[model samples]
Target: MVRKQTELPEAVTIAIASLRDGEKSKVGDAHDLLQDAVLGRQGCLRTDKPQPVDWAEAAWDEFITLMAHDNNHARSIAGQVLSNLAQSVPPETALRDLDKVSAATRDQMFVTARHVLQSMWKFGLGTKEVRRALVAEFADLFRISGTEKNPTLRRFDIVTGLRALFDETGDDSLLQTARDLISLEDDPTYRKKYSGVWRDLIDR
Candidate 1:
């Protein structure tokens, strides 16, 4: 980055160092100095203007490093960055180095995916293509997660819930999924939560 006539290289170096630790990213009220240093409020960062995004771009690994930061909010910021990039960037550009992000981010990935689903759908995932993709990805997750050993299949109710919320087919297919998941359950706990997912679908 091009340094301003009066700016010292060492100070910019120190600022970037603090940013890497996430200490300077508070986005706090000391806007005038922060803007001058990073985003350049009144052209304070003549040469360092490009460095902050560059730092963020580089700190992807650092973000993953901070994934287990003692603070959950810090973890969330890391996930949000991944989520934002996933939504706006082409899969090719955003995921070109998936191997780097994937192995490190297994836990954070689901949290980000749920954010994507919620932010994009703003309701139950509807529409054939969207539900198709959700089913492809999340159906299995929902199925085996609610139980263990002889795990109860919850994908059926989840899919049915989507059909009902969307009023899509609301048909035999959804009904069959319901039956399949319920039949796997010997435990009576699902007699409520699982049943609740499909009661309206069954009646309709």
Candidate 2:
């Protein structure tokens, strides 16, 4: 659910503090609060809103720093917040940090990597330059992911992101790329499972 504009300041304050705490040291109430603010509990803010952009703008530097934090959880949370607040991030800042975001997709921790992959698409929503970079980056990732251990899971995520991009921009090429990804899967069972990620578009 969307949050009241008045409540955004407090939430952003807490989230940035929690994010900082996660960076400073691991086990603490800040870590827990950061997780909740970013991932959210059932029916809560869920960290999905763009309204936090104002607050996020203030914490932009901190978030960028946290993106490379030694802790994987901090990196993941930082990446997601940056993506969610992409619209608020200056275009130059987003462009400069795109590499860091790209690197997170290959993070050693699968969960952190997956979170980064899932949210990276939002960076494009901020500007045309970012959209171009994000699309190119994701396409390159799709081309390379087949050699990974969990190619199917990664492809599924890629296609899902492509589908969202298609929906936003009405880009048929994005859908076609997703189809190409599905066709590249050698394992029929995994192929089918991954195709299910685009079932609606495929069937249509």
Candidate 3:
């Protein structure tokens, strides 16, 4: 059993502060430190299994608040970290904040939006309700992506996220959904690229 932590580590606290500082010089180092701290507690984050962190209870609120920070970097970091913590925090908490984190995918800065999108697949590792809600959210986002800048890229990420969720849950519907979305890509080159994402799954 993991011992619950009651507070953020000093370094993590300092890093969060620096990230909020809005100074470019401090942002980089702060990002590195906070990421390291999160990864250290979360273990191999790429796994389908949820690695609940001891400190997540202490850190969730702060990260949730930072998702709306004025600095895009802070928002990006908050979204990514919150996605990582989805499996660690209570299912209700994760479900409650899901839309807030999803909002970051529409951040004004495309890079920040992409960062949030890339990490959001992890939320599928939460409870069944969260997973279903996330699929619905991704579907809605993909359907409306045509009006967004770099629609193809946004579609690619959405499909990629679905593939990730499918891989983790062995959900056939998710894979089929991804394939169907790929078929809608009018650009042959991009369609092939999107298809490549499921190559291994197709082989299986």
Candidate 4:
């Protein structure tokens, strides 16, 4: 006999619905619930270990769709959750959807963009190809951020994200690329600020 498929956890289901709700009041609570749910299963955010979740398969497409939702809050939540879900999904799936995730880094709302940018390093926890794709995406972001408002801060985030990825993967090439990107900074003050991100890593 064919058995019935199990349902997603009630909290996850409600959180998704509330996030999609037009009422702004519901979003904050929903975001908190969804984040907690994903993190409870994800364990420490710094680790590269994959703790696959049953709900990830069902929620993956929904989160991807919400990345382009009308509300910027929805977009931000979607982007952040997608990054958290990266390790839960197949490595190839994460690599395939990298561009979609990267697009959120340019969201019209600067806060939304920053949220996405800061979370992107989580994608590097996947396979080597995923890490390679993440590095390429970071390189492109660093190149284009020069014209954006608060370019230095954006570049700082990119460099710091590379550091986080390097920390998780122990990949020397990632660390070298981050230092190389820092060297490209023309302003001494901003370059110094960027370099400081690596001081601890360098010392170790």
Candidate 5:
């Protein structure tokens, strides 16, 4: 007979302590237990049947409460938890608490990914897919760039996305324009983002 996997008592302790709403803090022992329970590496609380999916839901709720914990550790822990959820596929679970996630991601790009997720609800984002989809609407976004009513989207963040948009829309001219727009941007990261595509287009 096979021995059953132990649901470490620590797992329950952490889950209970982490249940406080707005109780942000750095990853503590509770987070570790949560991670183990959900990730299954450290130890599956119930070996009989893995509880990663269930653990994930509880973690999500706990993460929201931790968002306002007023502690760097708590915020960071919560951020990682949410990021894991965003990156999951077949989406072991759907983010029913989208509004809360959105609010949390507003300050940190790490968290801001949740905002990009808005696109996911409609389309999806995985670097390639998001860039391709974003291109279809690049013109609309660009149209607002220099206007009074612009949406204030992070243009730098949209460069590669626009490149993809151009690819799908067959708007080569915009590629040249994009190259010109970023011509003076000193940030190498921004240049690295799409300069290759623009340079390749110019050469072609």
Candidate 6:
């Protein structure tokens, strides 16, 4: 589905170039290119290899500034890229930018928000403090997003993110918090739908 070039370094280069264009209101191309680089095909990134970490880390400073771009599109892409680079850069960088990435979870574009939240696990990789913070952040967001119109799906997405983190870290606290959040849903049908998300995790 991603028509863009699949090479990691090349993709990061194109994404950064598009980000520059984004500053000038030329985000259409940049947004699309970055999305392909981040999302890849069938929800899997094309450049899922270890090499992308170096390329992504090289562009770290650019991403930090881009996360603050006036364009939400740029913020969305930057959040995803920074998350991807978390494994390569100092864990502190990701920890420091956690707020910026978390803010993207509330982006007006639900899809953009979902992307940021989904990739957040990268921020916590190999770090317990960051992992605990991430779980708490999602829990807080899960509690807050309840005010939104379609809170059920929002909560479900939060659980999905938690599952990813839990899978990586094997932290029971994440699982407990995920279950706690799921219990908050009022609509029985929707609650049941969402509970199915935890079935495997709880069973495990």
TM-score of each: 0.36, 0.76, 0.86, 0.88, 0.40, 0.75
Q: Write the per-residue lDDT of candidate 2 for residues 72-164, one digit (tens) a residue.
A: 877887777677666666777778888887888888899988888887777766677777888788878877997665766777787777776
In model 5, which regions exceed 4 Å deviation?
Answer: 1-27, 42-52, 85-95, 108-189, 193-204
lDDT by residue for model 1 (60-146), tens: 454455545544434444443332223223334334433333322234444433322222211112234433443333344445546
lDDT of each structure?
Answer: 0.38, 0.68, 0.79, 0.79, 0.44, 0.67
For residues 66-131, what per-residue lDDT tens digits would candidate 5 score against the true structure? 666655445545544554443232232233444454344344443333334222222112233433
1-204 in candidate 3: lDDT tens per residue?
233656778877887788778687787777777656766643433332445667777888888888778889888878887887787777778889899988989999999998888888888877788888888888888888889988989998988888887877787978877877787778899888888989887546
Minimum summed lDDT over a 10-residue window in model 2 is located at 42-51
Model 2 clashing-pair count: 0
* Candidate 3: C-alpha lDDT: 0.79
Clashing pairs in 3: none
In model 1, where do residues sit more than 4 Å from their true spots? 1-71, 77-131, 146-183
Best by TM-score: 4
Once superposed on the true structure, which residue ranges of model 2 sit more than 4 Å away at CA? 1-10, 23-52
In the range 42-132, model 4's lDDT, one tens digit per residue, is 3433223334466676788888988878899888888888887786677778888989999898899999888888888888877788889
Candidate order by decreasing TM-score: 4, 3, 2, 6, 5, 1
Clashing pairs in 5: 7-45, 22-65, 24-69, 25-73, 25-74, 26-73, 26-74, 135-165
**Going through the candidates in order, what is the number of backbone clashes in each?**
1, 0, 0, 0, 8, 0
Task: Report lDDT (Cα) of residue 110, candidate 6.
Answer: 76
**Model 1: lDDT to the true structure:** 0.38
Q: Give the poorly placed runs of model 4, Cα more than 4 Å off.
A: 1-7, 41-51
Q: What is the full ranking by lDDT, best candidate first?
A: 4, 3, 2, 6, 5, 1
Expressed as tens digits, the lDDT of each residue in 1-204 for candidate 6 is 111222356766776877867764556666555555544422332123211334444677788888777777777777777776665665566577788878877778777677677677666564677677777777888889867645766787777767766676677887888778878877888778776867876656
